[model samples]
Target chain A: MGGGGEVIDNKQVILKELVKGAPKESDMAVKTSSISLKVEEGSKGLVVKNLYLSVEPYVKLRMKKFEHPDFSSFTPGSAMDGFGVGKVVDSGHPEFQKGDLIWGIVGWEEYSVIKNPGSFFKIHHADVPLSYYRGILGMPGMTAWVGLHKVAAPKEGEYVYISGASGAVGQLTKLGFDDAFNYKEEKDLDAALKRCFPEGIDIYFENVGGKMLDAVLLNMRLNGRIAACGMSAEHNLEEPEGVQNLRIIIHKRIRMQGFVVFDYFPQYSEFLDDVLPKIREGKIVYLEHITEGLENAPAALAGSENVWKQVVSVSRE
Target chain B: MGGGGEVIDNKQVILKELVKGAPKESDMAVKTSSISLKVEEGSKGLVVKNLYLSVEPYVKLRMKKFEHPDFSSFTPGSAMDGFGVGKVVDSGHPEFQKGDLIWGIVGWEEYSVIKNPGSFFKIHHADVPLSYYRGILGMPGMTAWVGLHKVAAPKEGEYVYISGASGAVGQLTKLGFDDAFNYKEEKDLDAALKRCFPEGIDIYFENVGGKMLDAVLLNMRLNGRIAACGMSAEHNLEEPEGVQNLRIIIHKRIRMQGFVVFDYFPQYSEFLDDVLPKIREGKIVYLEHITEGLENAPAALAGSENVWKQVVSVSRE
Candidate 1:
């Protein structure tokens, strides 16, 4: 613990209560506290000065608290946690150094002291944008890559449909699929499969479910594979509409699977091996929408409906 | 068409104006036709005396031209098409002859001239109940087998969740999945995934979406897979509710896909190789809630609210 260092109180955004439909400003409250940024002497912990925080649609989940046998829901009045890019201002662990720039699980505040650094990765490519840690270079990037390559396994000339296509992960993944697999993007989701995939949709990286999924279903080829990615379109609706054309699943003998990033975390290095060099070589195009300051963090994460890569730079860069 | 055959008008159940939500008896009308059963010499079609017709929940889709694209929705006032077992009364096609047992796509009537004799597969497994083809060995049965094995691709010990678990296709598919993959039976549904899948669900054959899908999303393993098979749960709901855990898709990387059977026709023979032996042996179990009579065909195809697979046998034998 740095006893003599000037300790600024940590400010955080917390859910005021379970949100209803689209969130309003009242759904959250920003709380501040003068807490020491130090792990216990013997604890395997790292104190980080958060340089960047990712603004993602997934945060809406923290607004609800539901009991699950396998998992716990987000409780009200709790600090929001997500992937953060930070510098090791102080470290009590051997794996991290004081000056190292690392990205991992952290809070939406100026600084955070994390104990269970389960999947945190040290930012090896500091020469590139650190914000990339949250995007093409990071979670959203890996989300698109893993889903398209690993789960969906798109082959060249296969019809690939992405729902939340304009969103951060959606856009990057579309390019990823386009880049990795020789795919010609077809706009008429249904007709695209008919035109591009005369044989039919071989692989689908599903990001949007509703109308997009409906259109894609009609053209899915036999033995088609779909990676169930996300449903950003149906996220805020009161009652999610039942998807039509699911009967094709049985008829076409399709394969649809969902994946969590952590499930592929063990392959993170492998992900880096395949991705990082391409990113550095400028063979990849990355998009990042950065929102500066903590006061703007809540609204930025709330009000802004960005269709692509978005991030909240919580601290003074 | 036969010119001298007894041209007595036979009755057929016809859907009138489009019905909303679950179909009712009033949604359909019975009309008589004087069309002869004899096939035209040049038509290359088989005159099938329908011994059994397969009425499945998917027929409900034909009740109206849903905005979400699927197979051509049933034409109003037309004899709706479905899979059925029949005896060939006569044939212009060289492959079919009188007294041959055949089943495939046919009209919902006693005598139907199946234009495409190729669609009908000659039933060799007639030793088992012919009605089994109306389900387990037929389209619904193929649906269950292929849907579970092909679409779901359930890994052993993966938490496999089926929504319309009690229906004929749902039950049959559930049985197949249970036999093919290791899954815990969960009927309470509201809390089934939670109680049965404390470690979280790995694969979800989504026959029922809406709230059940929402809850299932909450308990999914990080890289869980979902075969977006059917959403019978919210089929009737005008406006579906927003799923809370949808955003978990990005974090967990879940895949949700919709499909159809038309594309897999090539693999029909191969699918039989995997499933028929299972049926021939007492290894697989199937059940159908039979709604007797062609007069009740509309009501049967309408299917009950949240009820499992119900079959209406229009043929005597």
Candidate 2:
């Protein structure tokens, strides 16, 4: 059925059970299974060998059982699904053929057979690292672009403050923002914001919520804009920390909006057109913390302090 | 330089000192003074006989020693300044004449000399109740219209929720909102919101913040909008209550904005053009709790349960 094709063993990181609070390595298990490198006849599907898998904070949310209509929880004993860069091994689909490089949502396994290949995006640029699709050139990059440009609508000379200034989203925000600070180092976030932005912040890219948000509210200038990108500080907590200074929203006339990356998927090509040149010009920089094996993916996803973007290299290629 | 020359005894409401928490009647004192119904020669000022004075919640904020640049605190032993309707007794300014009806920021006294008549709005419609200028046709009315139409931007069939649904801002919100309920009556605000908005709330006119806001955050629909008008609950509290469920904003893609009425002052004439007819046709109903005399003004401002728009009728027209 194929030219020099053979059966192979697939190594996958599976969710052992639903996690309650902060995810632990014990909640997941690495397993090995055998699969034929061939797509079934009369089926519109393609077999892919996953090269790199992304470990994002949002994936921890999917590890728990929740009634989210848009996202389903990872089933126990099944391989976790996440954003990944892959190579098409075999295809019965009209759009994709063998050896086509693609990136999108894929299983956290060495090889996966995707029934609906509609979600996949074909990789055209061979010069750029394929792993970039797992970080800066992928979802996180689009998130930062849409949030700052469309949502926050930042203007030059305006003061900007971003929490979690070393993360995937915050690093991207630093390129556009006037001044960026790492919230982790600050003893008092309010005092820190005051020192950085004495005139007050006009735009705030909210990544870490809780105390950071409370402090930012105190330093916001009139008609300030806050792009609520993520609440990583509250994600692991059983009860999210209370924000008390929300009344300042009225005093400052602030507009705070929360958005999802999926909503901006249609503008992906336009985003690429703008960002690719910036990348080539060295105007944009990306930092990634990569884990080599599927066995260590759970630790990578659980995250570490000072880590930028957590990425898992599923295969050597 | 007087039309009706007379030295009238002015009954004035003066602040005794700065208030700590919820205002008491004793915090303000009623004092009597004399003012000539005449404007000094060469001075660009006018003398007015106060008819009605508005008792708004924001007046309480000015009672304390807060350093608000735009609005100064009520100085001890001095007459409080607030929105009121009056008839011009004498004028030195080119725009004003004797017997002209006007409304704007005026002293909480029977008769006073207004140095700057520039901020005042002339009452063109003699048919409408002059007291309406202090409440519905004035500040509170503008607040509701701008918050709903401009901020929330509600569409037809979209669910709307309003906390403190019996106050000045809340009553006006009822006319435009599909359904309304008082936050005071509900033992569990989240359950009440669930009962009222089974499909989930699309727009929330936040009047009472703190715990009520926490509850509303739970019941918000995807892409929901929250018009943060006032935080009455937190105004009197020593330490404002904390809101814990803000992470729901990210999950639901919600937009929460806070604005001041002064920003929308330019649109006042446009607002009157739309709302005046609704009042004439009896399509809109307004409730006013009128408290007679400057002696009772402090009690009225302290706020009473089941009261809508509190107005101090200083002089019977």
Candidate 3:
């Protein structure tokens, strides 16, 4: 081993067991263990101190056992892993060196040793807040960009309705959508959508599925497009709600497409180039609710229903 | 009006009233009416002798009162109009002339005056059976063509499933698609789809929606595409059955699109050019159930459940 260093205490938020329905704080535990800080000679491994951990709605889906390749379940007694920002403590990887800031999949812990750092992207723009990697410049931001620009392909002046407008990705909907709504506040989603879009919705950025999807289907215009981003409403439910108004899609000639942000990882550089300048110029505003320390990650994730982006800060530097 | 020759007695199938649920033979009445076979000068009108009228499943939708621009309700006490083959007896339009074979919207009557023949397409290829205009060369054919070739756009060897395989458009599904099934024969749609597509369905031609759509949603593969062609099961029901498996669309990254054949009307000539030779070479086999006379049109339309393509012959020649 090249950079063999003294062992240090590492605390990780571990999943006690596979969760069903709504996840509770008792489902996870913060355990501390000693770890050697070193990188094997020829193995392109990276030792990173996790700076911030992102709490996303999809994490709830992963908490339950799923056969889907996209939403693989977390192993019991293992540290929960998701998109996070980290600083390289030690590296054997050619692309990454010590002290380099990177963002990708990382464990919810004080430090994570990545066997393969190929998937990680180097944080080039350091002038902006490093926490932006967890919210605005990271997975959630790319989701809104890809779903709106690529999947929906909305036109100028078209009426766009975004469901779950208070989530991390949903908040970023302010980038291009004509109208955004907090679906929780509406007594009748169909009525609210009708009032916002008098003619009808041309594009629907769907984050909250179930009853919201049914309502959007009823209010869609002719040849409307829908981007099926996520279903936060159905995430915690064992049995999701039924959608009734799909027949309207036939009458209106609507197109609904589903996509994952990871599918567009190759275009992350392009996304960064396009969005970084916008962020710097104050065109896009990012709101984050940061919870300090790795011990608090479990509660932050469980109670992040109203928060736009719940980012747990593991270290200040 | 040079061709104002004869005032002939025309037998017409008139709609008694707007129908709900399943239509009945009693909903229509065969009445005799007089009409002069003439086109007014400088009016760009034409006098057509109806040869054959197509009995499509969508005609049932028109029987009910709907506010949708596409599926307009049929007027009470008026001759029901639909796609048909006709011979231009008299013409003032530049495109159509006397005795020219044409196919377009025509009433369920022997002879009629068309004030706007601009929508009519002149049949240049008279070599094919004229009845083909009511089946393969008509609206149903175009529906299958546009939905498959243009909308779904399935690739080679992809697992394709077609519901309602006995309908007019579904019969034409033999042109493309890896597998086909009559939803009527299948008891458990989910098991049937699993038996047909073990891995998963890449593209689904959704003709019979309702529960069939729910089952197909579960069997859809990652990045699957669905062409929402029709929902015969829901069309009859006053309240449609809610689709429960729409959340699967988000997990599978499925794209479902709805389309109308009229949107592709401008491309009909292109469709004829593509499909004409395939029919001439006997590559495509068309099955038609011919009902003689306009008086039986109502019965043929009402009881066309088992029939592939029901063509009501107003006049053989």
Clashes of each: 37, 0, 0
Runs off by more than 4 Å, candidate 2: A1-6, A19-27, A61-72, A174-180, A231-234, A293-308, B1-6, B65-69, B176-179, B231-234, B306-308
* Residue A288 C-alpha lDDT in model 2: 75
Question: For residue A186, what is the lDDT in candidate 1?
Answer: 53
| Candidate 2 lDDT tens digits, B17-120 | 99887778889989998888888767788999999998876677778876553677889999998889999988999999989999999998998789999888
In model 1, what is the error at residue B237, expressed in angstroms? 9.2
> Clash pairs of candidate 3?
none
Q: CA lDDT of each candidate?
A: 0.67, 0.81, 0.82
RMSD of each: 7.5, 3.0, 2.5
Better model by lDDT: candidate 1 vs candidate 2: 2
Q: For residue B9, what is the lDDT in candidate 1?
A: 63
Better of 1 and 3 by DockQ: 3
- Best-first order by TM-score: 3, 2, 1
User: Model 1 off-target regions past 4 Å?
Assistant: A2-43, A46-94, A97-100, A106-118, A151-167, A170-258, A285-317, B2-38, B55-81, B156-161, B170-205, B215-225, B230-253, B269-317
True contacts kept of 1: 0.43
Could you tell me every candidate's TM-score relative to the true structure? 0.67, 0.92, 0.94
Q: Give me the displacement of residue B142 in model 3, in angstroms.
A: 0.7
* Interface RMSD, prediction 3: 1.4
